[model samples]
Target: MNLLEAFKQTKFQLSGHGNRNIKVLKDAFEQMDEQQESDMYGSGKIIEEFQDKLASYLGKESAVFFPSGTMAQQIALRIWCDRKGLKKVAYHPLSHLEIHEEDGLKKIHHIEPVLLADKNSVIELEDIVGMDEDVSCILLELPQREIGGQLPSYETLESISTYCREKGIKLHLDGARLYEITPYYKKTAAEISSLFDSVYVSFYKGIGGIAGAILAGEKDFIEESKSWKRRYGGDLISLYPYIVSADYYFDKRSQNMDEYYEGAKTLARLFNECEGISTLPLEPVSNMFHVHFNHSKEKMEQILIQLYEETGIGLTHYLNKTGEHSCYYEVSVGDRLAAIPIEELRNVFNLLNEEIKK
Candidate 1:
């Protein structure tokens, strides 16, 4: 059988909380009151309360919910640029805005992005200090996801924040997986977020919600975003479903980040013990990391499929080719890892080591 088929058949998976099926949404709504009112076009108690909760949690004066992080972030950059009368912003080259957003920020908003730092490395304070051109805002992704969840030190983050405020440049956070990094940083969400002038967080990444995002900042900044939200066609008649799921899962999983962080370290160590296998970051700074295999993509797939069938422990269902002889996949620890029996997990890794050595 193919890799995905084998992974589907496995009894357990090493990444994510569980299958993201309709059941995920069903479970979130199971405990809700049948008469609970739904949000309408971004108003009503459901949407407003969740936004307030998130804003308070992130230490922002206000917050707004969006249908997607893509929409929220584009609006954020546009607002920053309009305020400064400069259509330019700075961020890592591997930023979602650069690689994944299809230039929406550039096309829809006409904002120019100044790419900073090396593609494979996290942006340092020095990179920001060295920028030649002026920008209205600087966006930083904590535990930079594209680089195997690598992170700049808290001291570096402080230095960058201080520099941005001193230069009148707004600092924005693309904190898609913010909850996953707090354990490593030993700080609360509010503490980390206070450094940024504005922050955007995703509900579906580490939080495992259906789909939604929160944009938080000063009251004025968020108020401006609401207008842009309507202009971007983001104001759906009802966003109660997404908001309900986000709220339920945030409560259920947010406190489990510390457990997930430990689980990630344990899993990474097991992978590193296997021959021809290594992990980015060597040690994970968050509950996510990339696993690299020295074998070609074709060979790794064959090996992983066999492993899954034999052990019924699915490490990953897919791999990405990095080179002719190198392949990789990402892992984010969650409730699923905790469900696997310890003895079975040990045996799976032991067998994985044997197969990789061959």
Candidate 2:
């Protein structure tokens, strides 16, 4: 059978909280009151209270819920550019805005993005200091996701934040997996977020909610974002479903970030011990990291499909080709890793090591 089919048949998987099926949403709503009112086009208690709670948690004066981080972030850049009248921003070369969003920020807002740093490295304070052109905002992704969840040191973050404020450049955070990094830094979410002028966080990522994002900043900044949220057709008649799921999962999983972080380290060590396999960072800074295999994708797929059938332990269901002879996949540790028996997990890796060596 194919890799995905084998993964589906496995008795235990070694990534994510669980299957993101309708049951995920069903569980979130199971304890909710049947008569609870839904939010209306961004108003009502359901939306506002969650926004307030998240804003407070992130140490922002206000927050707005958006249907997606794509919409929230594009509007954030637009607002920053409008305020400075510069229409330009700086971010890492591998930013989601650059690689994944189909140039929505550029197409919709006409905001020019000045790519910084090499594609494979996290952006350092020096990269920002060395920019030749002036821009209104600087966007930083904590534990930069594209580069195997690598992170800049907290000191570097502080230096960058201080420099941006001194130069009147707004600092925006693409904190899609913000909570996942806090354990490594030993800081509160509010402490980390206070360095950025504005922050955008995703719900469906490390939080494992159905889907949603929160944009938090000064009251005026978030108020402006609400208008942009409407302009971007993000204001659905009722976002209660997304909001409720977000709230439920945030409470359920937020406290477990430290556990997940340790779980990631444990898993990374196993991958590293296997022949022809290694993980980026050597050690993970967050609950996610990339696993690289020296074998070609075609060969790795064959090996993994057989491994899954023999062991009923799924490590990953897909791979991304990096070179003719190399492939990789990302792993984010969550509740699922805890379900596998410890001895079984070790046996799976022991077999994995033997197979890769052959």
Candidate 3:
């Protein structure tokens, strides 16, 4: 693709729902008026107030706000490692900490991860049951991203939590998309969060903030994390942009999670019926899933090029790995793409199949 055309190449986009900037501004203005519009860092009260609200919302004794999810999570690990007097954390092979994060847990936190689940599968309790008692904490991602947002059965989650309690191991939730899982489990965020010792929620994922994360746990745990946050350079001078935007998006999208669930199921169903397109998890358990392309990457790129040149849809973030004959692919459904009618998605797939047939 030429430079100009390359810049315009977008066939489908993932997670486009939380773009209500006007609403966000309105909320910010309202909060400013109530609080006299003091600077964010001048008092550190803004972040503390936000933490209090978040802690109560997550059912934790306290919460700490950070500039980034990565830093927040690593700090959690450091704390767990210190508490248990163990250096290892049990997590899924596809866990964000394992595949992503640039090995920050190892280099920064000085901890090791015991891969708990087989690659390409949701984590199971059995995976960690046989581990030595020295395991510091168990990290659970509610919707396994690489596995098409698959989650372990609630029974299994309960079993795992029970085991953690029995073994006296810490349970930490990588709840970046925790809010999105509530509808799937038919549970409330507080209900689900109560099962874990500590929960980390992202403000930018489903919440559509500029960028921020909240780590919630017992008062002591959260207080300790603040020290780690400062040490890890996560303490920001002003988190108001992230905080204000997060608060707005939380209020706006908390009511629409069910709608997102419906959209995810619909898109997965439509993709299943399309020729040469397949999805992992068969059914979407969250607002994201993977779509496999049953054509060579060269052919798929050609189709993507054509689709973008002719239409404005943005699909597939990176190269797919479906199978030998067809390139594999995955699609994440979120805000902008979800707003489009179901018929539009079906039509796109229809055109894709027709082009492949040609």
Candidate 4:
């Protein structure tokens, strides 16, 4: 099936989710060769340079690149726990480290995650204040992706950061979607990252690159992570393609995240104005959000199939809290969606409603 057809066969998706405009192998190779080409395969000078540049951009002293965010974050927590001589890392109940990662942090790092918030809310200072002691680090995602891209209030975030500092707890940001959030928060990446002791940004998320993640922190923390990376088998031979594409995408689209925020708001507004649909988290925190439908799963599936077969639209399925109900679904707005007019998308919303009426 074509890309759009493949998407529609699964679920009704009005959200621009997933990476797009990824640099092809040819394009990535060309970009890599633009610099002095070297065949010595490994995370060498080129890869190290990319890490340094990314760390500087994120306002950290050093960074280490990994094959996946799962590895990068687990290692970050392990290092924090080791340094602080504590076993618990505080995070939201819905943080990627808790829900996603397949329990990697608990299994591999041997670190306990103190889930601090409920499913819908971002972790706040109130959540942390209840914890008395023995927490090594606080892991906060800027926009909680699973909760329909929700974010804590700015003042609340500062309060939480200050509280962590006063309590002698390190703060590590799971910034998988950090780029998409800066525009909505009216903050630069460095400014948001400055509040936390360490920050991790994914190359493949908003930057539209292939699989890779960067963990940024102090020089000592990063140096320790290097040994841990080697221990975990993340030392890839050569990250040329991943690095080149990440650099290109970050350089090109880093400035346009504001445009993406505007488009996402426009799309969310259209969906909110339409009947038969409700948006999760009440508002768009980033370029991602969820759309809960009143229709049944069968009806949703039919609508998706029809849209993809008729109109080349890509979408993904949604899972309910109990994993049994499937009526509701999610939409992720990204760079590819900037071209589609908000009014045109509203027409699809009307179509979905009309289909439900039938």
TM-score per candidate: 0.99, 0.99, 0.89, 0.89
lDDT of each: 0.94, 0.94, 0.77, 0.76
Candidate 3, residues 210-293, lDDT tens digits: the string is 678999999899889988877876666767777777777787777777877777788778778877778777888877777777
Lowest-sum lDDT 10-residue window in model 2: 349-358
Model 1, position 140, has a per-residue lDDT of: 96
What does candidate 2's lDDT look like per residue over 142-167, in tens digits? 88988899999999999999999999
The collision pairs in model 2 are: none
Per-residue lDDT of model 1, residues 229-347, tens digit only = 99999999999899999999999999999999999999999889989999998899899999999999998898889989889999998999999999999999999999999999999
Candidate 4: deviation at residue 55, Å?
A: 1.3
> After superposition, which runs of candidate 4 have C-alpha atoms over 4 Å from their true positions?
1-23, 34-43, 314-326, 341-343
Taking the tens digit of each residue's C-alpha lDDT, what string does model 4 give over 1-358? 4444467463334555333443344555673546665323335677888888989899999998888888998888888899889888988888878877889888887888888878777777778898866699989987888778888888888898898899899999999989889988899898999999999999776777777899999999999998998899887666666777778778877777777777677777766765566777557777778877666665566676665655544445443432233356566665667555556566666775666667
Residue 203 error, candidate 3, Å? 1.3
Q: Which is better, 1 or 3, measured by lDDT? A: 1
